[model samples]
Target: MTLDGFAARPLGFVGPLDLSWRDRSAAVEVVGQRITAEVTAIDLDQGLARLSMAATEDSELWAYLKPLRVGATLSGRVVSIERFGVFVALDDGPDHPVHPGVGFITIPELSWRHVERASDVVQVGQRVSCEFLQFDTWQGEARLSLRAAQPDEVPPQPKRL
Candidate 1:
């Protein structure tokens, strides 16, 4: 059976996350050059391996993030909520490369107090200040800690046995 236009094929194809798409010029510069990367995952069936390649220097957000020091208090507004984390649009920074915000706080970092959901700690459009934890190279965003910015009460001494 032959089809004239856009027919569905039985064969399936899937590939890596395609690092080249983010930095084409850098990718072109490394043609035939040997480089090492940490394997994140391997799919034998697909004959592919996801690797964490060194691209910090090639990242566009590096210029805005390089000057920042860890633990520095930064302010931003909550832009989104996700099961994994919350996205924050920093008051002063370049737009995020992949996500809607340049700052991100994982669920664990959302608070010192136990919380059920991200919404329980913060809501969208809420202004918040968080301590800079690190630069997330994968998403080109800053890893932030909201709990660090808030004062934590000293724990009471444990009772005698």
Candidate 2:
């Protein structure tokens, strides 16, 4: 029972041959070592996690992992705060500025009022969750936002009546 040609192919494609091709991609190094990174572009040429970064080491590590999809979830620590927004440290190095536009919920943007400082909401050393919004591989830079990262407001819980 040997068929060298297509006619020899089994019907319904049963058995291991029918199994889907599983891509055994490499894993990201250092599972526990979480370093904060500013959101860069979502898609990279080689891989999903081949993310660009403004910071040195942080972006480098992220690029290696090759996240599975675009607009994935990322986490980082807040290093600095400004009226415009907050800055998070990408594991690579250097702090990435999370502007009010893409980073955090600015005080003004949060409530339509004057926000003297971003620290009022996000303080230094605070860990934040963000989405990989936009990426610029050529520039090695990314733009992120806290407001966009989270969902619609919960309406402040009504002060418990």
- Top-TM-score structure, candidate number: 1
TM-score of each: 0.64, 0.39
lDDT by residue (14-130, candidate 1, tens digit) is: 123323335644643333344444344566886555554433334556667756899899999999999898999999777765678889999989987777899999999999999
Per-model CA lDDT versus the true structure? 0.71, 0.42
Model 1 ranges with Cα > 4 A deviation = 1-60, 153-157
**Cand. 2 Cα-lDDT:** 0.42
TM-score of 1: 0.64
Q: Residue 87 lDDT in model 1? A: 97
Per-residue CA lDDT of model 2 for 1-161, tens digit only, reads 11124353321111222111121132232433433333333344432222212233344333533342446665677766766656565444333322322223334432233457776667788787765555533323344556556665545556665
